[model samples]
Target: MALALPRFAVFQSTVRQKNYLRYIHEDGEQHGFPQFSGEEIVSPYSKFEIERAKSTTAEGNDNGFVHIRCCYNNKYWVANSISSDSFIIAGADEPNEDQSQWSCTLFEPIPVDGEVGSSTTTTTKTTVHVRFRHVKLGHYLRSLVTRDNYHACVSTSYDRRYSR
Candidate 1:
């Protein structure tokens, strides 16, 4: 069976926030973990490529197994460790590496008052959120509540406050 692949997209926070996931630019180049930038502007640093993992079977395709690659730096997102609260960084330069793959699940767009879907006919663009679980770390990528820090890998089995 052939699976339909989703187009590349830029991820944004859905908790009534304006933050978008973007790679950090430092020392004259885009190098480092991606962070939530609330600049209200979508740029190349914010774009990401999603591709199907090579190890998946026809059955596994339905599970949404994939790899996320940063468009700015050309690196795959990876979780370094299984320990809770590990920083999910864009470190892997190779695609389909064990640590580079993720299980992606797209969620329905959240409805807000005075926004799209509030009326009978929706015309404005809607925002969709996604949940990506690291294949090797076995943790879900979550946005940090603090505005100063980057997103982290949190164990779904534990409470949010105790993520670290």
Candidate 2:
């Protein structure tokens, strides 16, 4: 089942080196692809707004598929093509269900030893980890290590590295 996602959210990488998804303006103007930001704190550049798709596919209707729009630029996320290893970028001025819609799912976050609270013996989880599955490409959204940074892309396999 799909988890109830917030209208606006900050997608963070689930890898060991955790970071939030952000877009850096190219040429200090327009057009920028999604990348993982090194900052640990949430910022306007990292926050995105979720918009419901106008129509749903038979396979994604029950999965709560939706379009992810960047709050910084007001552009929607678009899968490059109907193929594997395509880059997901925030460039679409409008939402197209076939190219912009993504099937979202929730995953249980891996717990780290030092991450647990010490004040209380027991603690309750409040946040939900999410992953975006490309409708046309049939791959999960993942980040690729580019030089010293990571860029957003799609992969065929299921892995925690794809969780945001």
Candidate 3:
């Protein structure tokens, strides 16, 4: 049996109630995830189109939603409308060491009377209510199944599992 991964919760209060984009850095800098300043250069193969498509699909909804674009090795991992506060990774890439980049965008909640017309207008109060959760189940797997020091051997696992 596989071990269960740990869960992380991102609350609206923790992230601040603001509708703005930012990044989380290794040095505990919430606004420094990319380790860069100014406009970011994205790859042509990046899932910019896919991200826009997904965002379009989430057009009007009352629930809070957030989209996060994670870039690494010229690859883009787009997570849309992550309503949950926690994330469980059976096995995932590392944080800072992997040279991965992440950008978070908060979307305003759609109004209750919003319509789906050409000029539909929704009174969605712009606020930051997206959260992130990083849980690693690899540790339990290593201790229970492989019986090897997976945490110490795999750099990615080590960073994701140990780093805060």
Better of 1 and 2 by lDDT: 2
For model 2, the local distance difference test gives 0.57
**Candidate 3 ranges with C-alpha deviation above 4 Å:** 1-15, 18-21, 26-50, 53-67, 70-164
Q: How would you encode candidate 1's per-residue C-alpha lDDT over 25-116 as one tens digit per residue?
A: 66533246677764554798788887766655323234446777888888777654445555656777776544343422221121123232
| lDDT agreement of model 3 with the native | 0.23
**Clash number for every model?**
0, 0, 3
Locate the minimum summed-lDDT window of 10 residues in model 3: 136-145
Clashing pairs in 2: none
Clashing pairs in 3: 18-128, 24-33, 87-133
RMSD of each: 7.2, 7.0, 15.4
What TM-score would each prediction reach against the true structure? 0.63, 0.67, 0.21
For model 2, residues 53-159, the per-residue Cα lDDT tens digits are 55543352344567788888988777554456656777778766544434222112222322432334476545555556766655666776555333333233445
Model 2 ranges off by over 4 Å: 26-31, 57-61, 99-126, 148-164
- Models ranked on lDDT: 2, 1, 3
The TM-score between candidate 2 and the true structure equals 0.67
The global Cα lDDT (0 to 1) of model 1 is: 0.54
Per-residue lDDT for 1-164 in model 3, tens only? Answer: 11111122121212223311213322432222221121323322121111221222222333333222343222222222122321211111322211122222322222223322232336633332222221111111111112332211111123334223
Off by over 4 Å in 1: 1-5, 27-31, 57-61, 97-127, 147-164
- TM-score of predicted structure 3: 0.21
